[model samples]
Target: MTFSHDPVEEVARALAASGLLLRGGFSLGEDEAAPAGLSGAPARSILLIGQAGPAPWPHFQRWRERQARDIANPLDSWSREVIGAVAKEFGARAVSPSDRPYLPFQQWAMRAEGLKPSPLGILMHPTYGLWHAYRGALLFENGLGLAEPHAAIHLCDTCVAKPCLKSCPVDAYSGQGFAHEICLGHVRGPHGATCRTAGCLDRNACPYGTNYRYPADVQAFHMAAFAGL
Candidate 1:
């Protein structure tokens, strides 16, 4: 049966109905503005940022699984699949961030389509407190505007410790940027200890969305991927 709803609205509804809350359109724009990592030749895109459902920790954990693979994070595969199906319905291709040069895209991504970080963290919420990730994005052959743009908010400006930078024992995130080799070292090392035990060092540090914690097994799986395992 042909789906009968506005594509963007349907995407938003589908995401919410799936127990995932949509972030906003600007985030997608930000990612696009950033160095796209092989998004299969960007045309225009309809951005959607979403997070797993909640109330039950297990469900929340299940949702975050979409971040990586190896173990059993259903969310990782689940979301990509969901996005793929959705994009197909709308004549678009889902793009995983890994397909392109990530770091080079960071600065632009940090400031996609004119969306900037705000004090309420309007730009930061929706997913993994900066620690969470873009496993991939849906690239539409044509860009479509949402019903309306997300209102600006300032959640991050109030943040004091900025623990996202300092919380890491190994200092994986430089705050100004990332330290890849050092991060992968522990992720793929003999022990593969702390990170596996906790989660992403920088990711865990973010104060936003205290509820979006990924289960231990899920965390381990993602770290393993980072190690190229």
Candidate 2:
């Protein structure tokens, strides 16, 4: 089936309808090298796909429900399946963040989207605040002539209050870096119920993109997963 729109645009539209977005992409050449582990599926370029804010939450939830009826690991499996289908449509190979020998998604995200990290270590999207997430990427054997990535203004720089640093009850996030043990302990404790049911307090405290915040149920679902519940 031939598509009238640009291949990237066509894929982006399809992904958007499914609650995903083409975050960005890059060509693999002399200046931009492909990762070593990707030898099994070498590609001339890669397209990074991700979930922006709560847009994909409902779609993901519905998919999760349907997949849960039969699959033991619905979320991961569903992500792989959806991204794989998209890759197939474009004649590319699908890769996920959860895959072994991790593909340096964070680095790819930073390079592909020119994004910076938030206080919570999650990449702070210029418009999505701390609510966005990378799902997977598509690797194509040839360049798609994707647009070049330019640095985005780091939103955290202009915020004088820096509420995210102060919102965590256990001080899990700060300039010193995340205290993983403390954060985990708090999430597993009795007082962690609030966080476990509503998501990270620090993340929720971010002033930017408030309208894009995930629904409480979606946040709670992620919190539950983080707490290993």
Candidate 3:
């Protein structure tokens, strides 16, 4: 069932009004497993929906202010609502990173955007840097005539200073791995005031996308969520 117009373009237009972008997409090979649809059938292609920077913050805040108090996982909830609407309108299945059993979103992201992970495991985009995020995705039963993701030059490869790894107050990130417990413990302690009020020092240290950095309030919200405060 093909449409006269490009469905991908139509979807992109619809998403733009909400400050979401069609990051990119890929078709699934017959041998590869696909995410199940609402009817429990496999989707043939997936288009990632996300924000490049702080574009969606204002919209999300507006919706958040109108919601009931004590809403758990407010951001995730909001993504589901917005992305779900888009999916419904386009006859697609909506999925989130926080979904149960976790749908390999990181792997999907790397595939879709040709983005390589930074030392912190965040996909670093050339333009958006460490500030972008994958809010949700639209899965279609049939191909949407999406273009293949193109590879970009890795920014970290050329970065000599690598200030991000050194900026952490607790040295949580290292070659071995991220010391999650230590990082969490520090964020919950008294000295965490800086990180709590601003954001992760390491993330802020990234040289790219300074203009696209998340606002202080947004960072605070995420910090509070991270520390379970």
Superposed Cα deviation of residue 178, candidate 1 (Å): 1.7
Total clashes, candidate 3? 0
List per-prediction Cα lDDT, in the order shown: 0.53, 0.83, 0.89
* Ranked by TM-score, top first: 3, 2, 1
> Which residue pairs in candidate 2 have backbone atoms (N, alpha carbon, C) closer than 3 angstroms, thus clashing?
none
Top candidate by TM-score: 3
* Candidate 3 local lDDT, 1-229, one digit each (tens): 3555788788888899888998888888778888897667898898989998788888888998999989999999989999999888888899999998899888888999999999988998988999999998988888766677898778988899999999998998999888989999999998989999999999999998888999999899999999899
Clashes of each: 19, 0, 0
lDDT of 3 at 113: 90
Whole-structure CA lDDT of model 1? 0.53
Find the candidate with the highest lDDT and give its number. Answer: 3
Q: Candidate 1 — which residues are off by over 4 angstroms? A: 1-3, 15-22, 26-45, 49-80, 100-123, 126-128, 141-143, 147-151, 190-192
Writing each residue's lDDT as its tens digit, candidate 2 over 1-229 gives 2558788888898798788999999887856666532345457778899987778777777887765365555667777888988878877788999989888899889989999998789998888888889999988776678777999989999999999999999999877899988998999998898898888899999999787898889888787667777
| CA deviation > 4 Å runs, candidate 2 | 1-4, 35-41, 69-73
Q: What is the lDDT of residue 208 in candidate 1?
A: 75
Name the 10 consecutive residues with the lowest summed lDDT in model 3: 1-10
TM-score for each of the candidates:
0.62, 0.92, 0.96
